[model samples]
Target: MTAAVVTGLGVTAPNGLGTEEFWKATLAGESGLGPVTRFDAAQYPSRIAGEVTGYAAEEHIPSRLMPQTDHMTRLALTAADWALADAGIDTGELPEYGIGVVTSASGGAVEFGQRELQNLWSKGKEYVSAYQSFAWFYAVNTGQISIRHKLRGPSGVLLTEQAGGIDAIGHARRHIRKGFPAVIAGGVDAAICPWGWVPQIASGLMSTVDDPARAYLPFAAEASGYVPGEGGAILLLEDAESAAGRGAEHIYGEIAGYAAT
Candidate 1:
């Protein structure tokens, strides 16, 4: 049996954009929490959020394509592009044998939610955008990602709560065992829409703190739920032999054993 290996990886975590940048901030214990700039919180009870800083959509993807997609899809596509390029798995010439994509997310099409609600509340029924019907669906990220890469091989999505993101990779590995030669698998999230966040206020999970460090306390003394977070990590998984043949570098780890019980 061929061992599953990670040849290339990318992430858009709350800590930062890019693997290096995220890692640097993470190891240094840097916090990304701040006032919610994406929305005017004069009415909302909680004002703090974990916003992604310094990530320009144009920098990650082309200008023309960015407008047509949601923030989460943009994030996943950008990371997937970088990961494939890093793996040197040039699909431009590869004959269609079998490839796959698996990804996950906690919330979907948040901005779509925000816009539609705003349009309805502020401008009444006539101003609603037509795209809202499909954009807010849970499957948008996987669909957009697969379409962009032309990876029509095989696709699946995991939405197992917060654990869904971690489980998506294992699903990809299973596909490889089932005969897929290559699989792009990972997950992402962008559930910070102000309208969508209205439920959180009732749920009583968010922080009311204005100070950054004191705002979001996940598992510490404060431990009053957690601040919403966004972004994702992707891994390129191929048979160990195939990865070595392609000369991909820096094998991260192996999916040797997993448990759910």
Candidate 2:
């Protein structure tokens, strides 16, 4: 039997941008929820949300990619980069076909799609950028990460909403069992913009409480609903034998088993 183990982790959450920062803040009982600031949510029923702060895309992403990706995809790419670095894997020396990417997304790229459509309606069809053809796709994150890292093994994306991230990891574990050495798997999502908010609001599952602290009491009887947030995590899943062969310094844990209905 083959074992899939977690070698590295990267996190981009509203509370923090990296794994260390997020962990420290979480242990300190800090929260990132607040009134929406990406746009004016003044007229919306639910105004507060978990928004990633202190991230300037220019600092993390190449200037050439700036015009080709959405905010969510950029975050995904950054997470994947961090995960690989954390694992101490020098992708340049590894076999391209030995690595793969599997990620999940729910909202796709609402902000990018909305902007393109607005351009189409207000200006002309030609005003829309060619990148829109894939920027709004749910699989864009997986594709972009794979391309950026030069990973050429099996790749895919899942869309099970909140469950998608875990599902992606499960799938990646299967890939590892099937002989692949390493796989980048996880999920990152962003849909806090006006266009994205409309559908979420229509779902009737968002908490309407104005107070950031009280808006997301999921386990309490006072729980109205859940608060919408952006960002997530990415992980490096490697076959146990391969990890040992590569002199991996740490093993977070093994994906010993998985089951879902």
Compute each candidate's TM-score over C-alphas.
Answer: 0.89, 0.98
**lDDT tens digits by residue: candidate 1, 1-261:** 767877778888878888888889999998878778877876888877777767788887777666556787888888888778777787654446466788888778788777778889999988877667766766777777777777877788878767877698888888777766778888887877775578777888677777778777666896656677778888888877776776767677777855563
Tens digit of per-residue lDDT, candidate 2, span 125-157: 999999999999989999999989899999999
Candidate 2 — worst ten consecutive residues by lDDT sum?
Answer: 89-98
Off by over 4 Å in 2: none
Pairing residues by index, what is the TM-score of model 2? 0.98
Q: Which clashing pairs does model 1 show?
A: none
lDDT score at residue 38, model 2, on the 0-100 scale: 97
Candidate 1 residues lying further than 4 Å off, grouped into runs, are: 93-97, 120-130
- Displacement of residue 99 (Cα, Å) in model 1 is 2.1
